[model samples]
Target: MTKPRPPLSKELQLRVFRRDKWVCRWCNRPVIFAPVMRLIESKVRNAGRVEPLSYYHTHWTRDGAPLLDELGAVIDHIEAHSTGGSSEEPNLATACCRCNVRKSAASMHEWAKRPQRKPIKGKYGEPQHWDGLSALFVVLAKRDRSGLTASEKDWLRVLAGATADAR
Candidate 1:
């Protein structure tokens, strides 16, 4: 026989809401439902799998409409809770539904580390921004991974953390 589910307390509900800023913990989309207690329960139930059923409520439009007029994409937990993961911004990522299902039960770090082709050469002779934001997007778009030099990579990493207002 299955064990009875525990009731979610008001305090616990508030904690989850506050922790997520009353938004969908994965996509950062605001949830329309009040209390959001029910949504939390659904996510917990489907927690272990890569594709949780609860995602529809969080990632989808408030009226249950599809994102981008389709299922949109998948939301992934960079670190699984089973291995002492925290539900924080750094640990969440967006993936396509197909990719998420394909990576089920696999370690996220291992899955993300797979080798791929490098990005193509840029039309601009040099990275325009010198700031990290522009470089980071270039890093994300390029396939050749070989393009950016080590020093450039280091600079981009440092710049990403720099304040926009900083000179």
Candidate 2:
């Protein structure tokens, strides 16, 4: 037979949820299906009565976004307690279904280092120009890689050519 776990105390859950402000700690935003419960006694202005706390694990999306439900939303810890992170309010956050899964087991600092934050060019964002010896090496390595696809090779060639012309 499966073991059943004891329910958490209402006061304790409320304390943790309130400290998190119903947002995911890592992303600092509400995820879609993060587990949230309605506090029958509490209400928010315009947002309605009740608040979200946590949700079922199944609701975590493949890309780490939270799924939304009629009841409310879910909150997640950026760094799970199992990984030596705290269970305090500062450790919790509200995330959409996706962000939570993506942030799994990662501290905010580690998650922020993910390459997902790539720079864009033009109006989308500013391009980060390569600088220093390491940057030059990346340019050269990209150019010299015979295994690179045509598009990648073309981009590397362009970068190398531009740098060479500048020098």
Candidate 3:
């Protein structure tokens, strides 16, 4: 019998998110934290603020409908694993919940060829702000890793230097 594939390590998952800047490779939409809804729910419980902050509250549409929260980044195999793709970084990308679910097990080429929905626009045709908690989520989700690949370590060092320079 074929051995069951091991689950991806948490570190690897975070790395993929960082590498992709928490944007879906397919749709380029920012993936927001799913847990923020829980945070809002907790506030509702403690502060008793009921009207605006419902348990089902999420990013709202122009039409006043609630857009479902994306929760967190999902690692998608650019080449489906069922088609012999390995779990290495090269084969993986960060995907928003919607795109990932829609893509399913389709090959990347097939997915790319499909028609894409137009991105939502704001008043005056400005792009809607989709990165609600991206910076905060990135900071909270990443962990320092001792066993990072050489490139990963180098990228972190560069980021550290940039941060230091800003101060």
TM-score of each: 0.27, 0.36, 0.57
Least well predicted 10-residue stretch by lDDT in candidate 3: 60-69
Candidate topping lDDT: 3
Model 2: per-residue Cα lDDT at residue 167: 28
Error of 3 at 17 (Å): 1.1
Q: Give the TM-score of candidate 2.
A: 0.36
Residue clash pairs of candidate 3: 34-71
Against the reference, the lDDT scores of all candidates come to: 0.39, 0.41, 0.58
For model 3, how does the per-residue alpha-carbon lDDT over 1-167 read when each residue is reduced to its tens digit? 33455788756766787777667777767665443333445545656765654433434332222333343457888988776778999999988767777777778788788875444333564324544354432342234234344544443443344465322
Off by over 4 Å in 1: 1-71, 113-167
Q: Given candidate 3, what's the lDDT at residue 102?
A: 78
**27-113: candidate 2 lDDT, tens digit per residue:** 443322121111111213224734443322334333222234321334456566546665556765544344545666666678788
Candidate 1 TM-score over all chains jointly: 0.27
Deviating ranges (above 4 Å) for candidate 3 = 1-5, 50-72, 119-167
lDDT for 159 in candidate 2 is 35
Worst 10 residues of 1 by lDDT: 30-39
What's the candidate order when arranged by decreasing lDDT?
A: 3, 2, 1
RMSD of 3: 8.9
